[model samples]
Target: MKQVLVFLTDGFADWEASYVCAELNKPNSGYQVKTIAVDLEPKTSMGGLRVLPDYDMSTDLALLDIPMLIVPGGTGWSDPINVQAKELIQHCFEREAGVAAICDATTFLGRHGFLEQHNHTSNSLPDLKLGAPNYSGDEHYVEAQAVVDRQLITANGSAAVEFTKLILEKLNVYQGEVLEQWYGIFKNGIISA
Candidate 1:
């Protein structure tokens, strides 16, 4: 089974992570989703929801054989003084894992030299100092949204549902109508061939 690790941090957006997991768990989807945090203890989200991670960052991530690593954006990524969170972002890029981030989480990618010269966006604070080609559109959420650059897959905001579907398509778990249905709901229109 293909495994995906969602890196949870303090104040992480619960919706993004939950939506991604929920979508990936759909019938016939061949993804094993797991949550990881900097530690094994329960970490809280911005909504006061606490989640117990399956593993710690210190674990042998390379050996875990995760093909993808997702990072959900929240106010936590904006803190310039948080070194550990920054380190986790660095680890994801170094591992050559299919990386995805939503909302303010994209800033973590930008700050760590991952987004340089790449096209991306976020729902976090606008007017960021990122060196990349920031594509901040007015849409509250992007549909069927993913920037497939090299080994990275990024989407903006709570569009994690669409992001998950994109990942499934990439993994050959779903395609054609199945993937179209997933995209239709969010894009407000059917995805035609």
Candidate 2:
């Protein structure tokens, strides 16, 4: 089973990762979910859930099969004082692993120039620019719910469903009409017998 690491921090938007996580954690999905954080301390989500991470910045990545890193939007990502988050991202990128970010997490990636070479999306082009003063990827920025390019996934804060769908597609967890059915049920709240 491949391990999917999810980075958590104080004020993480729980709903942002809820759908994808739920699916990822389902039995026999060929993937497993693991929580990681800056430290071993429990992180609180925006929706008031306290999560105890299974791993921290100190964990050895060589021991894990990291296919992707998912980060939900949160208040902590924009801080100018980063711990090991940037290093982790660089490490993942170097290994050609998938990097997914939503909302402010996208801002952090933009701030650090992580989205420069890839097509990405965020809260908005203007907001991304404003949040990430170092960002210069306007030409690569796509205006959409979510975008996947060069193994990177980015989504606006409101694109949780889209984000999950894209992640599922990229991970090969669902495809074709099966993928569309999942999208329709979640995105449109439609259910068929």
Candidate 3:
């Protein structure tokens, strides 16, 4: 099973990763979702859930071993102490691993120039520019729920379902009508018999 790393930090917006993590973590999904943090310490979500990370930054992982890195939005990204998280993200990117970021985490990526070259989206174009002062991807920014450019997947804060769809598509976990049905079920609560 391929490893899908989800970056977790204190004050993370837990719900942003809910659908994708749940789908990726299923037994038949052929993927293992593990939470990573700067340390082994338990991190609290914005929703008040405390999560004990499975791995820390110093833990050695094989190059390109990760298929994707899921980053959720949160106020924690505002904490300078978590800047070390950038290394893990850079490592994943260096290995060509898909990077999925949503909400303010998108801002974090924008601030770091990750979104500058990729077609991406966030909570708002103006908000992204405001949060990421150095962001220069205005032309690449798409006004949509989510945008996937190559291995990079980005979405707005309210587009968890859309975000999951793109992430699954990039991972090749689901395709065609099956993917759309899954989207319908979660996005619209319309499960077919």
Clashes of each: 2, 0, 0
lDDT, candidate 1, 99-167, per-residue tens: 877766676666565665455555443533442235443242223345656666667775677666666
Least well predicted 10-residue stretch by lDDT in candidate 1: 135-144
Ordered by lDDT, highest first, the candidates read 3, 2, 1
Higher-TM-score candidate of 1 and 3: 3
Model 2 agreement with the true structure over 1-193: per-residue lDDT tens digits: 9999999988899999999999998886789999999888999998899999999989998898899999888888865444468888888899999999999899999988899999999999999989888899999999998999979999999999999999999998999898899999999988867
TM-score of 2: 0.97
In model 2, what lDDT does residue 72 have? 89
CA lDDT of each candidate? Answer: 0.67, 0.91, 0.91
Candidate 1 residue pairs in backbone clash: 73-105, 103-157
**Candidate 3 ranges with C-alpha deviation above 4 Å:** none
- Candidate 1 residue 174 Cα shift, in angstroms, is 1.7
